[model samples]
Target: MPLYRSWQTSHAHIAIWEITETEDFFAASLGFGSDKKHPKRRLEHLSGRFLLQYLVPGFPFDKIQISPLGKPQLADQSLHFSISHSYPYAAVIVSRQQEVGIDIQVYQDKILRLQSKFLSAAEQLICANDMQRITLTWCAKEALFKYYGLGAVDFKEDMPMGSLQRTTPEDALIDMRLEKTRETCQLSGLIQEKFALSYI
Candidate 1:
């Protein structure tokens, strides 16, 4: 049970798992199939479901449906939830009372190359070319996008990353915006040894 971390927000249950199980283990226990082309992706899909059930006991898996916006949701929106995975890490946020979003990303240098695609010039300056900062910023916006649960959002323009404040070495908060709905809020983030996690 490599349940890396699990916590609760005011309205949601959140968890991040360091995938240490064999693919067969999850595949058999989950009994869920995946069409992901990569082996790691298949493992991630199964493990994500595992965490969803872990966080929300008796979660209605059968009611899951893809919205026109491409969000995986329930027909009645009974429980708003979101999921994200980064290789050996899988994260999920589930709340019966409100919508939720969560994202996890491993520290990777590739974020530098793609920063221009998702970060405004000002956001780039905020990141200051630091790898972890850049990765966390990207991760924050991703969480915002999932929170929106709508299609066709511009990462750099529609969802922007704002100032970051770290209260402790392992905990942080990011000021973020969702332009489509003109939303401004603080997104919670976690700084870990190998990955960054964010949610809203």
Candidate 2:
């Protein structure tokens, strides 16, 4: 599989790859061996390497650790990051001096099945126009969860996403805008009939 990588912002970098072939190459790119150990530990190791290569210098790959919730952290507490992956892609977002999280999902029918679990009643009412709205709602909520560093929180109860107005790519120069009772975040992406890609 080929890998596509780019810098989203000066302090933020994104690594996106289509994982159609195998996880071996992905693992190697993250500097992991095939040996089976602790999955969480291995993820931290990989996350560490990516951070050092792009953020720090002379840091040992194994020197980082992950929280029980699967968030990566430096054993020495120097950097912060989050990792996410979907069926065919994996992305890691890293920041040199701030907390960051990233999430990727392959838009699919499965999201519809869990709509009630994630979307707020207000969101549902606003998105009633089309089924695709449901997918975007889910993606937005998921991205919010990652941004807050709370994975899979009660999307309906914990982090309710308010109504969003879809802005043309040219109108706002951004993709989706998510609002909450207290804060707002921008999600950039495109939605097709089958799937969507969003970055927060």
Candidate 3:
């Protein structure tokens, strides 16, 4: 089990798993009831469950359901959780205290082409022509979208990437706004050697 890194608070815990095992490995151990046809997707789903269980011992995994808005929630909303994956990696965040969101993305230059779709002109200016910065900005907004826990979000308009400051060589502190809900969150992001992870 390649557990990459984890963060924890008094009521919340987030974990990431580097997927190196075969789908069969997770299938045997997880035995998830939903069988995804795509092999890669199946692996991601199983790994997410495994990580979720790891973060919160005895979480009611069987009670999980997707809301009409496409956010995963407990049948009774007893526990707040979120999940995300980028090929070969899966992430989960669980909170007994508050709703949560987490996202992990494998670093790729291709994101630049889609920046215009999710980022405004001002947002782009703040990124300042750096792919790493651009990638982290995108991840921050994605985390915010997940944090919002509802569908039909306009990335560029609904979630705006605010000012960014480099705290270290490979970490950044980001400010983001949820325009629709008029809420703000400060998120910390990590630029791993192969991927980027963000949460709030």
- Summarize candidate 1's per-residue lDDT along 1-200 as a digit string, tens digits: 89988988788889888898988888777666777898999889989999988877777788899888778998998888999999899999998898778889999888889899989999999989987888888889888888888868999988877788887998889998888999897898898888998898
Q: Least lDDT summed over 10 consecutive residues: which range in candidate 1?
A: 26-35
Candidate with top TM-score is 1
The candidate, 2 or 3, that scores higher on lDDT is 3
lDDT per residue as tens, model 2, 102-181: 65566666666667776667767877735566766665666666666645566677655545556763111122333333
Distance from true location, Cα of 169 in model 2, Å: 5.2
RMSD of each: 1.3, 4.9, 1.5
Candidate 2 residues lying further than 4 Å off, grouped into runs, are 27-31, 34-60, 129-132, 150-152, 169-184, 190-194
- Stretches > 4 Å off in candidate 3: none
lDDT (Cα) of model 3:
0.83
* Residue 49 lDDT (model 1): 90
Q: For each candidate in the order shown, give its overall lDDT on alpha carbons.
A: 0.87, 0.56, 0.83
